[model samples]
Target: MFVNFRRIRKCQCVQLITTCLVLSLMMVCWEQLDNSVVSHVKSYSYRYLVNRYTFINKSFTIPREEAQSFSNFLYLLDHPNKCKGQDVLLLLFVKTSPENTERRKAIRSTWGNETYIRNTLGVTVKVVFVLGAPMTKPEQLLWNKRAGLGLQGELLREDLLNGDLIQQDFVDSFHNLTLKLIMQFHWAHIRCPHADFIMTADDDIFVHMPNLVHYLQDMARKGVMDFWIGHVHRGAPPIRSKDSKYYVPFEMYQWSSYPDYTAGAGYVVSRDVADKIYQATLTLNASIYIDDVFMGICANAMGVSPQEHVYFSGEGKAPYHLCIYDQMMTSHGHIEDIYHLWKVATHPQVKQRTSGLAGRLYCTAVKLALLCQPYHFNTYPCKAAFL
Candidate 1:
């Protein structure tokens, strides 16, 4: 072939420039790439292939003296008798903020209503709100003192009216979620130890009382122990970026992957597991602010593995359908529509639609279409359609 040296040189230059550009782009995007891909790979490898997390116990443990500083908050609002004298099946601790009165109200009227749960479901499910002190921004602290007082007074009145509030003295903020987690276990241990199961959930989460109660009743009948179930997050890597809210410092948790944990949006544990978690909190360094991840560490220390329940949502709302409602255990991120969703989800038609062979087949196909998607919806996994 007749070739021109000049054209060949031009092509070589173009190739060199393209390769250099690609290299530079990769270098620039390396951190993101690590966060999205490399970190997960490392996490999964550490979680599954290597398969040992015993070191987490020693690494995360602090002296009991040091641990007390995190959990030794005074209870500002408490009802010691809330679960007393009742044969409580489930002690639900809904983590809420001091200012979320409307959320509490909605929950009480809907899923968290002990009265409705007793009358309709014929179960003694005790629902209580866990919270810390109302805090204001540093700059506004002085001016907001009065506002804080008003909020406090309102919380007291609300608690008196509902008799379901459990408050502590620590400042209520995102970083204090671990404290709230500690509070739940600690309070449950002290006040409601007789309950068959304990559940920790967010205020925004909606629990299908009928489904959850039935599940717990079965587990109780089977005499289940060390039982923990939720939307399992297996081999989840920590976010290393400083800007991210979920970022874990290398000094705090140097591990590549966390111990398997359920989504903190909602999860359930048997009475024994709750005691194990309470003991874990007493020794483990509660510095990890992400409550769910901390729960994973605690559970890992106590040798309680989280079981995956496909119907338990992580961070997304379940699909709005009768098939979903029929089998749904929990759905996260509910706020304004909580009352409406509660009414619809608990309607008798949901059970009717999923009852017989024809209904079962119809729902199976409908769920397969809704749940088995190419992309994750964060509510239920694709395999949920089969169940």
Candidate 2:
């Protein structure tokens, strides 16, 4: 009887182990199938949305030797003396006016400055200002031609005054210019080429570069590349009417549903993703909405998904501390709210006071810097050079 009982117990144990093994294999297969389905759905959707658009033929191929040389140049830029092992984060600012330029400088100098951010986060950061064209012009060719020249030159030489270039009727016109500037920078990368991640931001927004680096590092570990990370707004209403600057006719974008896209005020795209977007935009007609919707929503139809995190603020009204505590990459602030942004970013009392009555002197200093001054003159046949 004891021998029979032992045999039965051994058999029961073996069966239990076999069942667990089979279940584990099945779970793995199920997970892979789920991922495959999601990927397939995304691929089909992109093809359906963008197959009919005029394709832009731009090659991102730098010769093997040239790529090595370019990589060396970037290495030097990141590690000047070979002592700092820190990676460089490029902050590309898209500015529209001298006023915007001043604001950008101030924000960088006060809170968004590379020095301050690097010291705090222990990483190297550099800011590149890509001055954008005025927002008033709807004509793509004219805007591109004029923007190819510096903003000040365009103003003085082309008789392009603010009133002539900007239509105050559209509140988001400035944001649209921001989109154009992002495209311009992406093209610049194709021309010049540098940096691991390209962070595009507006003059009026506040960004924490350290947080962004951490977020991106995590994403890299997850094997995520060729993707955009930011605050995503899905199913936003399309602009209507010919008279309105934000108007989008049914013919322009026939799709009723838009994929999740990032808020344009600030977002990071991998080098591969940036190249894809630049190519996609050349084939697609420019949209008239703000930067986020035009690029995030429209380009997303081509398989871009906005990465969600704790930091992207779409409301545009919350305090900087709230955003910072959330570990956000970018937060929006209007011209009038610049002081508040600065104060909250720098001051200790920021966490305490959300409102105030006292008037503080927020001077918008204007400085005129010459175009193509000291920097390498890009005379090469590149798309950004045309911009």
Candidate 3:
């Protein structure tokens, strides 16, 4: 019946120490926890409970006259006739910086090569490098009246040699990416309206042209419409941190969850969807600077949901293996080794190694190992191993 007073006092001290330690740990991790877990909870709640994005449309819509201001940039370099007189299967737009000439060269030699696509794949794919005016340093802007004149000359020469550059007059900065997005859709609506499909990809991304062509051919045969496929981002919350490059202030977005969107790394839209997106661009507020998020807004307004493609990679590089190469539609973040990847990925041996019962079994095991990781590789989702 007697209480152990000393033991109780010791227990109280231990509890106090434990509480302090837990508080210290939480303080250290609170920012990360809020950024990830708390944000996701808020996003999902808004996405499901609210269930209506029409408000976004009503709020973001502007007069087409006002909207045209964003897309009215003059074309410094263009190939208006690039897709003319051809039964174009896919009009591929590579979102590129003005300085990434080497990356463009690498792409032309590998996946984006129109000659290889025409003769080898027997599909008419037009590759166009889309860019805005080169951005000069703020300090240099004062002295140089025409800040990008030298770069313009080089771009003109490059466009003449390659006949593939589509350069607009707006300064090519990350904040102006939505303008580039508008440029692609608007240009496509005018110049390449007959193309069966339109694909937009980053400069550093590797597209398996053969696989992509075959897939598009199959889809074309199926008479696919409203087809927009890539690595989809669903119910993603905006980053509220001002210090982050991807920060979205409450005044700008105000939404808890963004409508579903494909990764801006690479994505494909059928001609019909492209037209719909173009129409959306004519009226929607293009003030949202994140190109992919803006794309989501546009698609949401059009009631076009993004479809996830297993072979289409997100921001991460796909695992370097024949199994991955066999079906890869796109692999992002390939800067230096694109040529090497192209050579090995498209090797005839890949088909040989990944065919038949034995090959299938081998590939299944390989994919399970590479894709079904304990942590996300951000290449292919774990479910892709089965596919």
Candidate 4:
């Protein structure tokens, strides 16, 4: 009986010791978690608060008419082999206006040519021009009625002759450009969510299809996920001047500086991020006139910061030189300059002469000279290296 009693005591002792050790380990883990929280708070910037406050104060009310805007909004409008029976590497969505036929044509001929991008670069690509009709107007009421311009069940019957239009019924004006972006993402989520990456560019920007493809291919090899990359703007202050088009009053946002965002001129999002951003669009206050700022808001909700690439010029023209052209991705403000830039960028002499390391050295020297000269460098962010 004494031996049995001693055995019981030993068992109880072991149990007590195990319990004490587990409790100590848990306390240690909790201390580490508390320290991490302190570190996070110490590094907090106003940009972090901007995201939280904006999300917390989200005014995500969709009017009955607007709620109906998502259905049959963008049915296969000229998507070349849109990941059906194949894997699509990239899907490019270009935001275009209703009357910009010339811009669309120029884009189709130049970098927007899906066939050219695929054939030359050997990757599956699809391009779609996103469009929406202006708000229902009085004199144009009959035309709007015929075109099925709203949630009145006529949205699917609209006729677009060329078949490249991803038309929705929302008003396509500057005030509603953010809606345009929202509609684009919604369509992609429903139509092409399997795309490896989705890119959005303004109709005015010039996309260097070859360079972009190669860069993305390299990323694919590295197995990147949750990606967003562009010319990132960090710690940009809001335009409080009421006269400015980008004005944001204290009522709209209380933050001193806006969150980091890529310029609306052009940007890219990975496939998973597209769905997340689309859902974010529904939950955030998107009344901000600047589309990119709104995009930053959505991206922040998903904890994604855009990776910066210096070659992706933000609201500026990339410097015009063979070396710059060789590594450039997209240059903003390029409507009339699109075709000329394409020709210059893809010149035969460029291929024959500047083929390797020696060419890079010569171009780097020339770029240094331009930078040191003072006149051109001040106006342009000239650099020869590909980022």
List per-prediction Cα lDDT, in the order shown: 0.91, 0.48, 0.92, 0.72
By TM-score, how accurate is candidate 1? Answer: 0.91
State in Å the error of residue 271, model 1.
0.2
Q: Give candidate 1 regions above 4 Å deviation.
A: 1-31, 141-147
* Selected candidate, larger lDDT, 1 vs 4: 1
lDDT of 1 by residue, 49-72 (tens): 886788888888889999888888
For model 4, residues 51-72, the per-residue Cα lDDT tens digits are 3544433444445455445333
lDDT by residue (1-387, candidate 2, tens digit) is 437888898999999999999999999998767755664555456546554222211122334454232112111011122113446544344444533545654665654566676777665555544433343345655654434335445444322221112111121244346344444444445533444566666677766555566776676567667667666665544444456665657665554434456766677776667666665554443433455655653455456667654355453633333313223356666566666655555454433442233211110010012112344121111111112
Best by TM-score: 3
Could you give me the TM-score of model 3 versus the true structure?
A: 0.93
> Candidate 4: what lDDT?
0.72
Q: Which window of 10 residues has the lowest lDDT sum in candidate 2?
A: 359-368
CA RMSD of each candidate after superposition: 3.4, 21.0, 3.7, 20.2
Structural RMSD, model 3: 3.7
Query: Candidate 3: which stretches are off by over 4 Å?
Result: 1-25, 137-147
Clashing pairs in 1: none
The worst-scoring run of ten residues by lDDT in candidate 4 lies at: 151-160
Using lDDT as the measure, which candidate wins?
A: 3
- Model 3 clashing residue pairs (backbone): none
